[model samples]
Target: MKIIDAHHHTWDLSVFPYSWMNNPHPTGDISHLKNNYLIDDLLEDAKNLELIKSVHIQCQGGINSPVEETEWLQSLSDKQGFPHALVVYSDFLREGIEKEIEEHCQFKNTRGMRYLLNYINNDPINCFAPKEALLDTTFKKNYSLLEKYNLSFDMHLWWTQYSYAFDLIKSHPNILNIINHAGTPRKRDEEYLSNWRNGLKTLAQAPNTVIKISGLGMFDQQWTTDSIKPLVLDCIEIFGINRCFFSTNFPVDKKYSSYEKVWNSYFDITKDFSIDEKEKLFFKNAEKYYRI
Candidate 1:
């Protein structure tokens, strides 16, 4: 089947600074990813799959202007054709959002933008964007720029924050909100799953919000298809067929499984579904949402 990888990233350490990659990732050490991962590397990673198109998500903290990544990705797309769309980064609390957002949309392939709202409530010392980012008044005002520019947002936050997330989405219904990492149900415990599913159910109530089932590998040290299958299927069950899609999360998720193994697992989980149903989950829904 044709695939539109809805979330993945390609980075060149030589071109831009990625401060997050340099340090210890919350899950563990990801210093191994500090090296470059260009289009050639991505193609190599997905050799046997019918990988047709993809969306390049913003991959680092905004040490510099967020549009810098967009400019770089635009140039890359000018040469290499794979990342048909981009979800660049933006810090909503910052001033000059109007000016910078205008610059971001100048690129033909720019689709949306993402700001990491994954905050540690208890460990406020470690929080990057501040614990109250989504709830902050200034950030809320600036987030409206997405609607002004007619751009989507790739929202990546924990389920615990969905109460505030709902308020944010309701105020900006015009902005397409794509929830990343399957609500990021990091803990496999019963209580965590309950909260994750509940948060997702609330988000699904808003027609503008959708979810991407990626990054499940990080949930377990030694993950398996059966382990993640329920989470994958749960997202679909909540969002229904049209409002959700699967993504590889690519080289970042490479720690858990290969491109083939990941896609094969998705196929294995939904083997009984109709061909058209499979098509939407795999490619059709993503193609429509990202305007591919």
Candidate 2:
């Protein structure tokens, strides 16, 4: 079956700084991926995995850089030819954000915006929700700008904060909210599983939300396909095949396993799903969700 990897990232360490890669965190088998993975690298991996297309997610490096990573991916799409869509990051908390959105929308491949809200600080996480910016009256007036520009919202918040995100989406159901990494559940302890599963169930109930089955390899260093299958299957059951999609979460997920191994693991887990459902989760759903 054809596959569309909906959540992957590429970066050139020589051009930008990736502080997270340099940290001495205990990232199982992916400790060697502290460098750039250009288009060539990704294409080769895709060819090996037989993937038809990919959506390039923005790494944290290209965040404040003048060379917006989405545009950079667009330039690559024009020249190198692989990415079906680009999920760029934008700090909605900034001023005159509409103008930035307008400029980003001009790119034919610009799929949506991803706001990283994984806060570990004792801060109230909901305080950073995009809706909070909308409450400013000025931002609220322009809240429809995303739909006006035909852009989706790719959320990268912690699994626990998904309820706040669900509430935000209820306010703007027109905006498609793609939940990255199945809310990125932590798998280190048994106690965390129940909370993660309950939170995922709640997020899947939002009709406008699409759950991405990616980043499983990174949730825990020793994660294997068998270990992650229950979570993956649960998401499919809750969201159904239509609202679910699969991704490589590459290079980032490489922190735990090889690209080939990650996709192979996913393939093994979904081996028993019906062909149509598998196609939707592997390709069609992403095509529809990203309008690729």
Candidate 3:
């Protein structure tokens, strides 16, 4: 089938500074991904698959220069012709969001912005932001600026923070909110999985929000087809085929499985669906969502 990888990333360590790759804390041991992954590398990795277009999510390009990654990607796109959409990054709490947004929007393909809000109390190891980032008044103010630029918001919080994320979505129904990592159900315990399921359903209720099924490895590092099938199918069942899209978190997920394995697992899980449904999951939805 034709494919539009809804999310992935490309980085050149020599050109850009990705702090997370260089010095991941003891808990975030992503040293496996420290090497440069340029467009050539991604193309080589997905050589077996029909990867027509891709959306480049902001790979951790340092806190101070979020747009530098976007700038670099735009240069790549100018010559290479891929990464149809660029999801740039910006710290919402920081001053001058308007100026930052203006700077990012200068590039035509700047489709969205992601400010990692994956915070959990007492869990400094995994948390990306302050515990109260979601509830902070400044976040709401900074977040509101997206509507002005016609940019979408990429939500990356843990599933435990789903309610607050959902509430935030409800308040801004006009913005397109894309939830990453299948709500990131971080544990396999029955209670945690159940809560994660409910949280996904709650967010799916909002017509403006969509789910990008990626990063199972982040939660279940040793995931198998049988292990991730339920989570994949559940997300599709909740969001319906039209509102869900398949993505490869890539080099990061490469820590657990290859790109082909991840896509094959998705295909195996949804084998019973109609061809049209499969088409939407694999490409159509992403084409429509990102305007690719």
Candidate 4:
């Protein structure tokens, strides 16, 4: 079967500072980092893995610099085999942000916006926290602009903040809201599993919501395809294959396993699922959600 990786990332490490790369913690050691995994790099990985397409989610290095990043990716789209869709970043809290988003839409492969609410006071390195100003009326007003443009919102937030994402979606039920990284699951904490499952259930009930099967690499760097199978199956049970899709989250995930291993993990997890379900999880859901 041909696979379509719904979420992956690429970066020119020199262009921006990915501070998390330098963290001294056990999980932060990035000795495996590689250079220039651009179009050709991704294509080779995909061809090797039998993946037919991919969607590029925004890298943290270019936060709030949506235009420059989109243009760079656009250049790649023009030059080589880029992701079928691009999810770039934007500050819904900023004034005239809709205009910026409008400009982004003009790009050939641009598909949606990623808010990246990962910032915690103690963890300034991660880009998955919600901005404090997101709750402000002004910000919500700007967020409402997404309805006008018919764009989707890719949310990168911690499991604790899932409720906030739910609330935002409830307010704008007409807009498409995708929860990234299965709400960034932390399996080591057994207590968190039930809560995460419940939260995922709630998000699944929302008519306009979808979840990405990505980012397990960040939580457990040494995790293998077998190690993540149970959790992936659990996600399939709760969200259903139609509401879920697979992503590599490469380079970042490369910290844990190789691209081939990550792709094989997804393949293994869905091996028992029906062909239709596998297709939806691997490709169709992403195509419909991102309108690729």
All models: lDDT? 0.85, 0.75, 0.86, 0.75
Write the number of the candidate with greater TM-score, choosing between 2 and 3. 3
lDDT of 3 by residue, 71-168 (tens): 88999988888788999988888877788789999998889999889887887776778666889888999998888889999898878888998898
Give the Å error, residue 110, model 3.
0.8
Model 4 reaches what TM-score against the true structure? 0.89
- What ranges in model 3 sit over 4 Å off? 22-28, 62-64
Please, what is the TM-score per model?
0.96, 0.87, 0.96, 0.89
Ranking of predictions according to lDDT: 3, 1, 4, 2
- Candidate 2 C-alpha lDDT tens digits along 1-292: 6788898888887766766565443234445677778888887776776778889887765657423776777888898777879887666656667777777777889878776666444544323353444234554445456788888888776666767666777888898888888877756576687787778788777788889988887766678888888888878887888999888788777667777887777789888888987788888999999988
Encode model 1's per-residue lDDT on 57-110: one tens digit a residue: 988534467788888888888898979999987777787677888988999999
Clashes of 4: 7
Steric clashes per prediction: 0, 1, 0, 7
C-alpha lDDT of residue 122 in model 2: 50
lDDT of 4 by residue, 90-146 (tens): 766567777788888889888777875654456555544445544567667877877
Worst 10 residues of 2 by lDDT: 125-134
Q: Where is the poorest 10-residue window by lDDT in model 3?
A: 19-28
Candidates 2 and 3, the one with greater lDDT: 3
